[model samples]
Target chain A: DVKVTQSSRYLVKRTGEKVFLECVQDMDHENMFWYRQDPGLGLRLIYFSYDVKMKEKGDIPEGYSVSREKKERFSLILESASTNQTSMYLCASSPVAGKRTNEKLFFGSGTQLSVL
Target chain B: DQQVKQNSPSLSVQEGRISILNCDYTNSMFDYFLWYKKYPAEGPTFLISISSIKDKNEDGRFTVFLNKSAKHLSLHIVPSQPGDSAVYFCAAKRADTGTASKLTFGTGTRLQVTL
Candidate 1:
């Protein structure tokens, strides 16, 4: 069983403040992803990392960035939090790409961030 | 453009009945499909999946049926229980494309089961 742990279950931040959402996976999967969930928008990818220090922008990456300094940890950074940035953030990991055609992602419990 | 779409936003079913959730995709490149169940405040869990090669895949009381020509899929849960009440999301990704193989997910269908 792959266990993906999120550092915070819920967080509240003020506008213009910087925020960090951390995630760590125990299975040592090579791919990590950050997504934001919104009503009518579903899960939109914000950023993803395939290797340490390597990151790629997903569909919606504005005002957000990610850091992957170690193999097991991935962090999502909100440069300047705003009321619109409030969302349920999810972290997911999967085995190395192309390892299997039918591979599925293991997701962390998620972090609900509220920007006031 | 939103490749995957879940037309119905919500569905209600009585216990011991069948709950059907539908999904559709516009991209023909999508070869693999998956269904995930998400409870409130929790991440979605992988329920079941079906490849383009197969039209139907079943696990326990959950079944997924895919129609390639129509580019649509549906998940059917028989004898639905209260525990099955949650948001169901349909996700799909193209075949074995190493790095850029990101999945496109539908908005989701919220299912409520009444006893």
Candidate 2:
């Protein structure tokens, strides 16, 4: 079985603070993604990394940045946390690139971040 | 614009009854569709999927039906149980030229099954 682990299951941060969410996958997948899920808004992509040091912006990348310094780890950075930034963050990885067609995603248990 | 939409926000059903969750997409270029189930505080898990070439797929008590002309798909769970209560999300992927494998997700529908 594939295992994707997130560092924190729950976090509380103050406004204007910097926050980091870490994720690691044991499956050696090539693609990693960060998404924020909200009620009535669905899961909107924040950022994705296809390879080490390569990143792309997803639909809603504002105020969010990602780092992929190694193949097994991906990190999501909140430049300056705000109350509106509170959300459930999810990390997922897939083995191949043709995810639009031929791959299945393995997801890590989400981190619920609260910004006060 | 929202490419995928789940109009129903919630559904309530009795145990042992059938529960149907619906999803619709406006993008005709999407060739693959997937269903995911999520519990509170947990990430979404892949449940079932179907390609545009086929119209239906079934596994155990769950079934997925697709209608290309209507650009709609639905998930059916028979003999629904209380444990089946959760949020269901539908996603679509268009395998066109440069879109990569990124999936577009829809707003979820919360389902609660009672005794």
Candidate 3:
């Protein structure tokens, strides 16, 4: 079984503060992703890393950034936390099963962030 | 644009009955579809998936049916149990890009089962 662990399950921060959400995977998957879930918006990708030191912006990358210094860890950084950033954040990983049509993502529990 | 949509927000069923959760996608390029179940405070877990080449995939008591022409898919759970209660999300990916597969997900449907 694959295990994905999040650094914090719940977090609270004040407006204008910087925040970090971390994720680690035991399977050494090559791809890692960060997503935010809202009521009507579902899961929107924030950022993703395909390899160490390589990152790409997803559809909703604004206000968010990512770090992949090592193969097993990925981190999401918020430059300035705000009420709008308060939501459930999820982390996921998948092996480079193939370029297309074959990757299965495994997800971590998720972090519920509250910005006041 | 919302590429994927799960119209029903919630559904309720009795034990031993069949529960069907529907999902629709607007993108024609989507070639792979997946279903995930999530409990409160937990991450969504991979349930089942189907490729464009196949229309139906079954696992245990869960069966997923895909209608490519209509851009719709449904997950049916037979003899639904209380343990099946959770939020189910429908997700799809284009798989056109190399290395990274970005998934588009639906809002999700919450399933509640009662005795």
Off by over 4 Å in 3: A99-102
lDDT of 2 by residue, A1-116 (tens): 88999999999999999999999999888888898899999999899887889889999999989999999999999999999999999999886654553446778999999999
**What would the per-residue lDDT of candidate 1 be over residues B9-92, giving only the tens digit for each residue?**
999999999999999999998999999899998998889999999999999999999999999999999989999999999999
Reference-based lDDT, residue B110, model 3: 89
Considering every candidate listed, which one attains the maximal DockQ? 3
Which pairs of residues have clashing backbones in candidate 1? none
The TM-scores of all predictions, comma-separated, are: 0.96, 0.95, 0.97
Chain B of model 1: TM-score?
0.96
- lDDT (C-alpha) at residue A83 in model 3: 98
Model 1 CAPRI quality = medium
The alpha-carbon deviation from the true structure for residue A107 of candidate 2, after best TM-score superposition, in angstroms, is 1.3
Tell me how much of the true interface, by contacts, candidate 2 captures: 0.56
**Chain B of candidate 2 versus the native chain B: what TM-score?**
0.96
Model 3: colliding residue pairs: none
* Tens-digit lDDT string for candidate 3 (A14-90): 99999999999998789999999999788999999999999999989989888899999999999999899999999
TM-score of chain A of each: 0.96, 0.95, 0.95
Local distance difference test scores for all models = 0.91, 0.90, 0.92
lDDT of candidate 3 over B1-115, digit per residue (tens)? 8899999999999999999999999999999899999999999998999998899999999999999999999999998999999999999989585777678899999899999
Residue-level lDDT of model 1, residues A27-113, one tens digit each, is: 988889998999998999899888899999988999999999998999999999999999999999988866773258788999999
